[model samples]
Target: MHSYAAVLRTPHALSTFGAALLGRLSYGTVSLSLALSAKNASGSLAVAGTALALFGATSVVLSPVRAALVDRYGPRRALVPMAVVYAALLTVFALVTRDHPGAGTSAVTLGALAVCAGACTPPLGPTMRTLWSQLMPDRRMLQRAYSLDGVAEELLLVAGPLLVGVLVAYAEPAAGVAVSAALVLVGTVALALSPVPFPVRRGSGRRGSARRERTTRTRPRGLMQPVLAAAGVGLCLGGLDLLAIAFTERQHQPGAVAWVLAALSAGSAVGGLTYGAVSWRSAARPRLALICAALGVALAAAGLAPNVYALGAAAAVAGLFVAPALTTAYLIADEAAAPDARTQAGAWVNTALNAGISGGTALVGVLVGTLPLFLCFVLVAVPALVCAAVTLHGENHRKRH
Candidate 1:
């Protein structure tokens, strides 16, 4: 608690944290909002799914570029305008879909608009982690901050959909999208104005040569290992979501799907907070491997669960390892990246995660009807365990080198 307090006590930390979190909350809404809007407009689930997939694909493609821009320019310069543009695009999408319901051209335009929004979407998650590193340079406090971040992400994942659902139910799907845009615009603007000192391009100075040497020294190697590992984590998460839904539906408790999924997120949030509070003596990489392995085992158990309640319990246990694994993955990526390229490095993790989710969701969709739910869970575990083994191998190879 004291460690977490230390991070909070940093000047402007609360404001920046709040803004970043609010900005990220927008992420949770966008997919659902787009899907709902497209479905309403086109009267087709297929169109909705395609729009959502295009959005995710665009985001995965553009994340690293956005992060690199943040690295080159200050966050304010890079993020503020992008946020405004992204919000405007969201508004445009909502209005276009609403006004031209069932128009094929509107769907195409919405897809194009989604692509633009993806390009302009502020990299809030990576940027916040970077800000935490800068504000709380102490390793323990930084770990806590990262854990808090992971927990917040889990919360957003749970809440974002709920919020969108409520809005769409009470008003319309376009309203949910508009609110999502508003959150992104307002939150990002506040964060941009916060008094955090972000990194900028190198300037000509007498100490330039020393700075250059330091940059070279801190340059990261073997970055692909961490990126791939993060993706595997995402794959497991995405697969779990689909499997949980299927499990609940099989039990004739489709309504309980939300609660079961919430159990997973709730468990993850608690676990993240606990993991952050502890002081660990082990190196991050090996710990990452162990956590990944644990996640696979727990998820495999979830597959074998005989009842919905049992599956939920197993999922909670699986959730316990999620934040720790992700936090460690982020730390590893930071350590492996060049100081100058840290933002982009973190973005790579984000990209991999998005890609993994997209892949996992698509894969599970194809197999949902054909395969048993238990078998699906086991299949999902394979990527996670593979990632763990690969991480162990990479670490060993590095030692040998």
Candidate 2:
């Protein structure tokens, strides 16, 4: 296949991709929806914030565990039950918010529901990537598929909040929650039915995801390269979000923060697609380290921008490496794992990225208020440079031994 079109033309590609995006879209919606629903029902920002935090805590922390289920059982068996139960909990949560007024709902009850709902959050993104690994054995084609997947995901996250904003204008925030439930339920069912991940018979002359799952002796140590790289990117992004807002405020153009941040996402989208379109001869592991280093350099330079326009441009430049870094990391992680553990491997990267994002946000929040923005940006970039140096140096050290 010479183009992305050819990659999409592969069997079961469109159906599975569509289903995965639909299910993944729920994640984009649920955050805002849950936050709004909690606030409206509880009428206490503290309660609402606590509920959302608890939800995120369980969802992000338990991601790999859920992915492990997909690996242990099968996507069909593991995903269906998780989606159904997750959807049910979301529906019940919506209803609880709808029925209860301020003080009518106990804080404990809402917090528990949020935690439970998050715990069952299906691992759609990781599963879809695993399906991609199964569908495209050609390294080049798989890269295209991942780039397509990553860009679409970026768009969905942007679109999800806009959708919730529109939805809440017509109805309660709970309506958004209900819609999220429906989306996941329908999407998960379709994905589980897609033609992928069948266990291949021995001597079938084709590799299968399930064929590797039945084995126990698989080295997951190679996972560190991508995981660390992903964490570095996530930390950079998380800190950048806050830094952008601070910059805009200082410039007296607080409204520009939206487009400034949009610039970041735009850069990532273009970078991801362009990365997929290119055919690289280098291995993904080394490519990931280099991209992370490039991202760090871009971000470090961003702090030195003289004005808002320059800052936005620097951010866009930094964004260029963002998607490529993550896409390459995914490729490396996928290659590191046995077929059965592919989902788990991908989930670990996902978890690290999300955790890094959360940590970066918190860490930057503290730093931005006290330190100069320039210093903050430099601090955030350190993670990426260190992670990159560590990975590359380890590889070099191993070569000499």
Candidate 3:
């Protein structure tokens, strides 16, 4: 493992890592903050869920448009306004949601504002992946960079929510969102000033190619393919998130919710380290995804277990696949994107994945009042199996094509 000191020793690494850390921290704090805020405002899980869903759904819906702006105007130009807008919206959310736990009208308005703000901020995942593609010298080094990033992200998600929970317990629920906004503003400005803003490569060999060239461009489609797969994976993840929430609430220990979620995040950290150590030498990768499939199935079983320990054990298995699957998806996507569209392409995949998760959450949330928790597990597992099947199909398709 790279030490913190080693990562910070260079200006380039520090900038990239700082941007990634802040972005994840901003994103991770939303769930806990929204949940706490909504609960405080309306005294209902339903309202809290709505606020969270709005933020996610809005972000997904707006991502493509934001990407378009980035393509036309350049990321540096597009980033500033978006970041400012997102920060403003989050601040509004903090103030409005603080004093109105059950004010239906206020909550609804704040949710809308929050969602719009959330959507405007271009996803940092794609930008960071694009940075990885450009800044790193080689695959081995890039893999390490991404692996370290995965660890940092997991830590952010783990620590961010826990911090929010602690704040809610001692001070106020709204502090979480405020902190998120402050971090986003600070980190985004730093990213904008960094030398990595410029694209390392730009051209399209297929720009004016014949039909055959377009068909076999091996660029844009490769990028889109991961988005498709990531969306499917997102669906499963969305369900898992809702399952975790409902299950934790049922356990009468809502405060321990982060730990339950962290089980999966912890598993991802371990899996990322393992994946970084291996070399996947092709775009037609299925082995790692197959492992993810098995993990999802195991997670479903864990969700149905009679106790928390058994549940955690199952979650560990499920979590183990998280990083490897993501790593493979990203590697293939990067290999496939047009030079000019790399960041946009990566962001689209992320958008698709997150959209799928949000959609899953909405679908599963609807099922919460009707279905048993075990049944919900079954429902969530079905999509994960589908993701696995599609990944396997991609493997076969690679062979035949």
Ranking of models by lDDT: 2, 1, 3
Residue pairs clashing in model 2 are: none
- Model 1 residue 151 CA deviation (Å) reads 0.7
Q: lDDT for every model?
A: 0.83, 0.88, 0.71
Candidate RMSDs in Å, in order, are 2.8, 3.4, 4.2
Pick by TM-score: 1 or 2, better one: 2
- Off-target runs (Cα >4 Å) in candidate 1 are 99-105, 203-220
lDDT of 3 by residue, 1-401 (tens): 44335434544877766876786688778768877876776777877777887877778777766765664455578776788888888888788777665665356675787678768875666666667666765666566667667677768877887778777887677788888888777777776666765563333456635532553476555665566667767777788887887787788866766677778878888887777766556443576457557756876787577766667667777877777666666766666766556666667777777788878888998998898899888788776677777777777887899
Model 3 — TM-score against the truth? 0.81
Ranking by TM-score: 2, 1, 3
Residue 169 of model 1, lDDT score: 78
Clash count for candidate 3 is: 6
Clashing pairs in 1: none
Q: What TM-score, over all chains together, does every model reach?
A: 0.92, 0.94, 0.81
TM-score attained by model 1: 0.92
